[model samples]
Target: MRNGKGQERKASPSFFTGEKWLVLTGLLGFLLAAICGVWVILYGGPVFPKGDVLKAFSFNAALGVFLLSTAAILPFTALGNKSRALFRWSYIVLALYSYAAETVQNFRGVDPRFVKGGMPFDVWVGSIFTFVALLLILFYLFVAVQYFRPKAYRLRPELIVGIRYAMLAVLLSFAAGVWISFNNGRLVGLHGSIIWLHGLGFHALQVVPFIAWLSERTALTHSARKAFIHLAGTAYLVSLVAVGWQTYLGHPVLEWSVLPVLAFVSLLISLAPGIVLLRRQSDQTVPAGKAIL
Candidate 1:
């Protein structure tokens, strides 16, 4: 990790870094996503499609990017540090099984959960896949619970807060996954799918945190930055609830009228704080974060 000159050398990103096998596994997820997405495209215009690979690959790609991106920050979280080796390793292995199940079985045109006929894929493989998926959810829930307290996980002030909220959202995502499983499908009715709520829940990993990073770039006070984080986080959470309610009512959130309005309005609320902060700083000659940039 160093040169002959003895200057502090950066650790190169690789398999050894923070158990980055997760990132490698995540890339495989994206590859599966691309494959399934392309398959759906070629299959033509059916919204639901013949097979359920749309949700399969969608889950892979979304969780892929999330797991991949969040791996870098694992070292920063106290629960993810070397002190908690067993928990860390267990999560990685379980996650591998869960993701691998999706990638392999989905590509084979088999439902990893619902396979029948008492074949090996159904009795053993599918059962194991279901168990692993549940285990992975518990693992993520453990993390979310641990990381919700900043004292438990260390990071920059605003970012730590964002992480707390994001992980909480991920916990909800896992909950939503369970809901979908019990319901046997994402569709709530004629047009709505809980998939809307499920998919976007994972996205909180980026949404509010990205806003935190953006807020850090302004000439705002530290307290001001933190306040903006809260505002944005609340708005984002509200948007999720609005969308969830819309989906549960068997109406697509994006459909015209109140359904779309409620979700979009919540999103707009998150933007207001950032906009106000940026506008207030516009008169200043140099932004506070210019040096860091």
Candidate 2:
């Protein structure tokens, strides 16, 4: 592709070829997870009593898809060849083990919770899964830092910034997940919460970049586009924090509360400057006789 200066820019080497297996497997896993999610929504009953077969299938499927997808995209960052190979193998092995462990625990009606007398097989396996998953979080954190480094792999600034924010969110979510696991899935007041925040945070990896990409296609100036990205990321983080605060207060995510309302209002307030800047940028781009709609 040619830049504005008419110079041709060579595309970065595609990670897809090297990671084809991961991509394919990840896509398959995601499809399976989607099917399972639908199945559980339609046929399954309550989500509790943890050993339900459909629930297990759905949960494991979702986890597998997430791990596989993470593995697939991780090499796109600035890892050296050796590091990339090691991460790839480790991720694949851990993902496979995690799926197997989940299946065994679910089928055998094992609870992930540890008992005073002895830990069940499921708890042991689940602990292993948690450990491996947390290790992967370190890799994500590394990638997040790499995004800001001088020699980092080239991408649009929006994508780099988005990924960095998303990884931060993922790290926070994983840390919270570890805490909840140790506390037997809930703190005294919080009950079995934190899931909402964790889910929202982790998915920011997709959501922020997608929004940034869409915004890049608009007629905004580079600075205005960046303003939009920063605004969106800040709003996203604030929303997560608000939900997390709610959960910490031992409230359901959707429960009417001052925190959430304030959070959204804060997001809108934070976005106003960006909106104004974007409007000015748009106006500047218009022709003398033409009006901006």
Highest TM-score: which candidate?
1
**TM accuracy, model 2:** 0.75
- List runs of model 1 lying over 4 Å from the truth: 1-19, 37-55, 116-120, 150-154, 271-293
Q: Number of clashing residue pairs in every model?
A: 0, 0
How close to the true structure is residue 50 of candidate 2, measured as C-alpha lDDT?
54
**Tens digits of lDDT, candidate 2, 206-265:** 666555554545555556666667777787788778877877888776655797676567
CA displacement after TM-score superposition, residue 131 of candidate 2 (Å): 2.6
lDDT of 1: 0.67
lDDT per residue as tens, model 1, 111-183: 7766665457546878887788788787666666665664542234456676677776777777778888888
